[model samples]
Target chain A: MWHDRAMSTTGRRVGRPRAERRPDSGLSAREELLAAAAELFTVQGYAATSTRAVAERSGMRQASMYHYFGGKEDLLAVLLEGTVRPSLDLARGLLAAEGSAEARLWQLCRSDVVLLCGGPHNLGALYLLPEVRTERFAGFARMRRELKEAYGRLLADAACCTALDAGEVAVRTDLVFGLIEGVILIHRSDPDRPVEAFAAATADAALRVAGAREEDLAEVRARAAKLAQG
Target chain B: MWHDRAMSTTGRRVGRPRAERRPDSGLSAREELLAAAAELFTVQGYAATSTRAVAERSGMRQASMYHYFGGKEDLLAVLLEGTVRPSLDLARGLLAAEGSAEARLWQLCRSDVVLLCGGPHNLGALYLLPEVRTERFAGFARMRRELKEAYGRLLADAACCTALDAGEVAVRTDLVFGLIEGVILIHRSDPDRPVEAFAAATADAALRVAGAREEDLAEVRARAAKLAQG
Candidate 1:
């Protein structure tokens, strides 16, 4: 579910054996904590979840959880960061690549949609939590801003976008970005809906919103398909 | 903030007077309770908010709250419905109105963006709360689906949409509806955004996603302007 699970992949911690068995999900101790927090926060409301509950869900003692995360917020910060950082990485690569910015933009949107919709829990929806808006989560907020900026950059460089004024480009970027994150609500309504199709349709809509030409739409799809491969 | 405030506007509940003075916001007692619940749920996490807290916020005793709502879930149910029902009503009217379906669709999307962004609390975001997914809120979910169908009908009738198959029309409608609800995240990041401008650009992008021809966009906007007046 965690297609974006990245961070501190280290050797397992040899903690004192506990009665509760943690499922061998192949995630490291820190990743296990993040996974547990993601599940608990989304399934049960965040405010109702305690750090103790998170630790228990991850099969660790409350004291032992501090070894990985400072508390619940830290776990949230990492998960939020995890979601954006992968998309940001892909965006940077796409921006540096030589293909038409149109194709790369489509590819970027497609991949970002997959990431947002990929996870078991709708972790992307967590961005709306009032807690995530606080100063404590500023880093996650900044990374998200950077990710949006990457969208803007790819979108701005697309030949179709050249005709747009600065304000228009910014507005289009906002809408395009909104459409990508917006899928969380759509996917929730039909959880069984295939992520691949959902991601593709959203990415296509994003390109359309960014002013991709109808005549060139197939070319954009072809080039994007190529980029996805290599 | 309450541009969509409707429901049981049946006069003030003449309960035993409470000690605290209620603000003269020109809203009915039931409206006051709904407003208080909306503010508390969005500002504080929903699970953390107590009906007592909502009652106190509205300057009423906890005992008096039951006169309006059964409990916290009821308050949430009303708030969620309030967010969608107005838009659904507008969509239904737009569906029945005589005019280009394109213009009506644009108008519906624009008006919805305004409603979602106009509120002081991001009540639309409350739709993402897992608790709302429970059977208790199925009524609210049905209202939202009805609204989406409104979008689909107008979209399916749009001249530009005639070329596509049913699946394509459904996908475009999904993206268009997604773009409208998706604005909550964008507006949250820039709360200062002018809803009118934001709404217009979004409606335009929605039309674009719905396969409205470029040649017809200006016409759609012009007709939508007239519809806005009459």
Candidate 2:
């Protein structure tokens, strides 16, 4: 009976047989499953990854996994929402912050870099699943549109603050984001290269283009100085 | 017997064969297959693209495609080598040209953007392909490493001409490339966006970050004036 109780329990035992687990908790089994799926999906392409693999990573039974996520697509939806929505919110907040346009824009870019790199592995398993990348994901298109508008607004604001024009802002925003994302590809291709170094270098480079003065801001200036020293 | 003779004939026959006969040289048919495959591979990814589908798109037999390129991987290699190699060589030539570092570097950047955007559809296709991206394809790693070194060298030269340090060159190079490639992604993602606008914007932004001014040279002055007027 003790063995049976221990077998069914995780961390604590409840006097129940074949229970469906707790109905509510912080990051329940379902949320955990989705998290696992997101990590796996981003690292390995979706077709290469499997539900069983996700279950293994999550330390749960395959049958129990289905009970939480239903299927791959459902799991994908949840993972996408969890991974992107938060970052999107962060971007919005940073862009909407009360500061000089350049400062707010800098914050927005920094926040995106943080969100993209702050994960189990940088950017999580989102890239692994191309299905969400395509036109099929329910809100993916809308999300992309919103993101473009937000970025555009941030650029416009930054330009206003920096005394740059719309054209200049558009170019700067495009290039900065590209370097951040583009270096991700390079880092992934060459695991030997330090992702942190690339991220720092690229981030500093981007800020320099944004007119970050070395004498004005000590922290970002220091980072840029280090990269320049390199 | 006459039909077989006509079918085996190369180039345009003296008589018409459009309605009742097929060409003998099969060169046109082969070219069509290559074009179709490149298009599909760019959009859908290599793993998802099939030989039969490529053949159908080309209006040729799948077996005939094998005769031309051996297999799909060979086809892909041809596309990469055929398309990207020439452009890369051109970029190298531009970078290596004898001039002031700033002049050569500017030429390299401008020519790179031009060569990369050589075709309307294939500009970003290489980056999109799974087989071609992330060091999966043969020669891609070596090519990428060489490209990086070349970029480093060009930046070093720029710093030397500008009397900046190695570290400064590194930072400047990162920002310059980041800005250029980043804006390229923006223009590519939205076809309606003017390419010239993107190019000028990126060039101007990079020049600004590099501390370039009208006094730099007559050419820089000319380009800057063009951009300012635009």
Which candidate tops TM-score? Answer: 1
Q: A178 in model 2: Cα distance from truth in Å?
A: 2.9
Which residue runs of candidate 1 sit more than 4 Å off their true CA positions?
Answer: A1-23, B1-23
Candidate 2 residue spans exceeding 4 A from truth: A1-44, A50-64, A77-83, A120-135, A159-162, A190-200, A211-230, B1-27, B81-83, B118-136, B160-168, B171-184, B207-230
lDDT of 2 by residue, A25-118 (tens): 3565655676677667655655566888987776676766655555777777665555457657866776656545545445445545555555
lDDT of all predictions? 0.85, 0.55
- What are the per-residue Cα lDDT tens digits for candidate 1 across A55-168? 899878886777666788998999889889999999889878997998998888888888888888889878888888899999998889988998999888999889889999
Q: Score the docking of each candidate (DockQ).
A: 0.70, 0.26
Q: Every prediction's TM-score for the first chain?
A: 0.88, 0.65
lDDT for residue A204 in candidate 1, whole number 0-100? 83
Q: Write candidate 2's Cα lDDT for B1-230 as tens digits.
A: 33443333464433222222236434465567678887776556566778988977776666555545557877777676654465467558746566555555555455555545555454344443434544436675466446556656766765333667777676566556645544434544554665565555455556545645523545763643443344
TM-score of each: 0.90, 0.71
